[model samples]
Target: MAEVPIVVHPAIEQGGRAVVVRNEVAGLAHCDREVVEFLRRVGLPLSDDILDDPVWVEWRGGRAHDYEAA
Candidate 1:
């Protein structure tokens, strides 16, 4: 007799949501409009908890990092 294999997927329901997942590709922001549009799409103004994430820390510029710490 032959056995069949089963495949499992984690959190399949959460797909297609606006979340900052690591290692996913990010496009270059060509202009200020693109930046604002991305933020708007992600449902900003984000809460402090969201802002405190390490991914955000890594992506922010030096000046913005200073403001984040303050």
Candidate 2:
């Protein structure tokens, strides 16, 4: 499959990451579930294990599914 164009931006000071779909701000996500929810809102398909799909999700400033604070 091609890249999903879904970007889970770096977590802010509050440990919440911004979910962006196609350059649009879907919403703020605090966990992996929220990221899935945001992707659904933007009309994206599931990949069985989306959070671990590097081609489906672009994670920055953090590891995949690591939105929690340090």
Candidate 3:
């Protein structure tokens, strides 16, 4: 299968994570719901468990619920 284009970058200052899609910045998501929203905004098909779906999202520098830098 193809690599997922959506990546939830590490949370940084401003307490948000940078959501990237296809090498472009989609938006900063602060929570799981927001991440889902961003994906929807980009017209991507995602399940309710998107945060846990490795095939759909690649989480880096933190876990799915990590919204702050460690």
Candidate 4:
């Protein structure tokens, strides 16, 4: 399987929705409105291909350190 390069940041809950920060492909950051537009542009299957990568497991578990701080 090809490794998908992505970074999944901790999800932020705003109002009643959960917003996740993600950096994908060419280091482009996506959150909030950008995420919606990304879904519209790339669609779910490609999005799922990126999201299902094992590299994100550490980030989801909070084991990955904050990238901004480093």
Candidate 5:
């Protein structure tokens, strides 16, 4: 199988090391409404907005492999 491309959010660094890394879906869905609207206007799936909340970070982390397999 071909390796899927993953889009990680620009890392959030603390003390010069990355402390947070979220998938593009989670990052974009959590971004400003205008950005979400633009993505929606472009016909991208919006069903994953549930990934936006910080509470879902661990869940999203676990799912990173799924993205990588996409």
Candidate 6:
């Protein structure tokens, strides 16, 4: 079996690292919007305004990947 590629976006801070890591397997199995909605349904707070920002997305992705803080 081939290893699924992990999609991640790095944070915008100086010296920041990957803040979000999306598992390709899961992402392929489920839609990204659905996943986000699921998180919201599960009481995971998310702000639409924040989502609208590319930097926040990067920061979120990086944080998920346990990247070092900038």
lDDT of each: 0.32, 0.82, 0.85, 0.37, 0.34, 0.39
| Candidate 6 residue runs with Cα over 4 Å from true position | 1-29, 48-70
- Tens-place lDDT per residue, model 5, 1-70, is 4322223233232211111233234233333353345445545555455235433323223232133221
Model 2: per-residue Cα lDDT over 1-70, one tens digit each: 6766888888887888998888889998998888888888878887668778777778888777787655
TM match of model 6 to true structure = 0.26
* Candidates by lDDT, descending order: 3, 2, 6, 4, 5, 1
Segments of candidate 2 deviating more than 4 angstroms = 1-4
Where does the lowest 10-residue lDDT sum fall in candidate 2? Answer: 61-70
- For each of the candidates, the C-alpha root-mean-square deviation to the true structure, in angstroms, is 15.7, 2.3, 1.5, 8.2, 10.3, 11.8
TM-score: which candidate is best?
A: 3
Query: In model 1, which runs have C-alpha deviations exceeding 4 angstroms?
Result: 1-26, 46-70
Model 6 lDDT tens row, 1-70: 4432233344444433331223422221122354355445445456655444454343244344343434
Stronger candidate by lDDT (5 vs 6): 6
Top lDDT model: 3
TM-score of 3: 0.86
Candidate 3: give the clashing pairs: none
Window of ten residues with lowest summed lDDT in model 6: 21-30
TM-score for each candidate, following the candidate numbering: 0.29, 0.82, 0.86, 0.27, 0.26, 0.26
Over 4 Å off in model 4, which ranges?
A: 1-4, 15-48, 55-58, 61-70
Which structure is stronger by TM-score: 1 or 3? 3
- Model 2 score (lDDT): 0.82
Candidate 2: residue 19 Cα off by (Å): 0.9
Q: Residue 66 deviation, candidate 5, in Å? A: 26
Point out where model 5 deviates above 4 Å: 1-31, 48-70
RMSD of 2: 2.3
Would you give me the overall lDDT of model 1?
0.32
The C-alpha stretches of model 3 lying farther than 4 A from their native spots are: none
* Candidate 4 lDDT by residue in tens digits, 1-70: 5443344455333211222334343222233344344445544444444444565322442333332322
